[model samples]
Target: MVIVDDHALLAESLELALNFEGYDARRVELPEEPPSETKLVSLITRSQPRIVLLDLDLGQHGSGVRLIAPLARAGVDVVVVTSSTDEPDWGHALHAGARTVLSKTMPLGEILGTVRRLNHGLSVLDVEDRERLIRAWMGQEQRIIEIRRRLDQLSPRESQVLEHLMGGLTVGEIAKLRVVSEATVRTQVKSVLAKLGVSSQIAAVSIAHQADWRAA
Candidate 1:
């Protein structure tokens, strides 16, 4: 596993902590000194770490969130470690396909547990966080149902497209996986977005994410 943070001290501490837990951890300080994105990617790819511990607030200039899709595409799991209790951050992290979101304020044991759970293909969120997400999901699910009812929409293909969308699959990736043309996938995505009355893929996915569609 790898840990990325702007704070060198925190990275060192986490390196020791994770090593103690048998993670074979390495630490990287994502300071402004790093001049190239290619360098960071090369470092991470060379390390071939199974997971990355990222800090959302990387000293105001960088975003660990932006690394989510790239790392995930590289077959790595990102577990965000931050002190922010903001709902939007949590949603963004989840929407970006983070394996887990852990608060820095949480107990060490809880953090460890979350890490273990995520490594096992499970997600970990605080109870309160889960409740809040569920409530938001219920509202969104109602909205989706209403929209679908009104439009008499969501054919099997469209629904499949929506499922892939919710799973964070890009149009190109989905097309390749489904053995279809990118244009076809793009059209299906647009149709689903129009039917749901949502203007963006992220918003459509966010609704399904909060609704716990896959979890259920």
Candidate 2:
């Protein structure tokens, strides 16, 4: 088995423990400066482990989630062992053809037990749970599409005003910051509210939070 993760200490520890348990496991640390996807995939494929354990967050290397599809396509049994509790992340992994997603919070013994089961050609993940996560991921994707449609209705300046509102600014405050009149700011705020389909600033901000919007 091969472990691909950026947390060197944790990866090394897991590797040592798995080896001690009589399983041939090794750690492949994701470097801070990551290589292109093609090179990265090539390196992983060369190792040719029976099973590949991966982390979703690969530090500056960004999400290793995208690797799931290609690795699975190459006939690698990709097991995701991650710290992320987000259902959408789990769902995304399942959609990308991962064998299963396991939490790091699960006891090492339990994790190893699952690996043993996989080696023996037994089912590891529950079908119901897997289906649930896939549904959550699909729902999350739909919500993002809808949110984009709403926000995309805003003019460029309205987008800026929405960002300012999310930053905890009042209309008057935004006017001063943008060197505009109070009436102009209020008009823009009204337009933002209308475009976002929210009657209040609080609701509009909630939408931004859901979209993980950042001020530009």
Best by TM-score: 2
Query: Model 1: runs farther than 4 Å from truth?
Result: 125-216
Most lDDT-accurate candidate: 2
Residue-wise lDDT of candidate 1 within 43-150, one digit each (tens)? 766789888888888765467677777788889888888878765676666667677778888877677777778778775666677556546645555765775463
User: What digit string (tens of lDDT, one per residue) describes model 2 on residues 137-184?
Assistant: 999989988987889888889989989998899998999999999999
Reference-based TM-score, model 1: 0.55
Cα shift from native, residue 60, model 2 (Å)? 0.6
Model 1 clashing residue pairs (backbone): none
RMSD, model 2, all Cα superposed?
A: 2.0
**Residue 10 deviation, candidate 2, in Å?**
2.0
lDDT of each: 0.74, 0.88
Residue 203, candidate 2: C-alpha displacement in angstroms: 4.0
Task: List the RMSD of every prediction in angstroms.
Answer: 13.6, 2.0
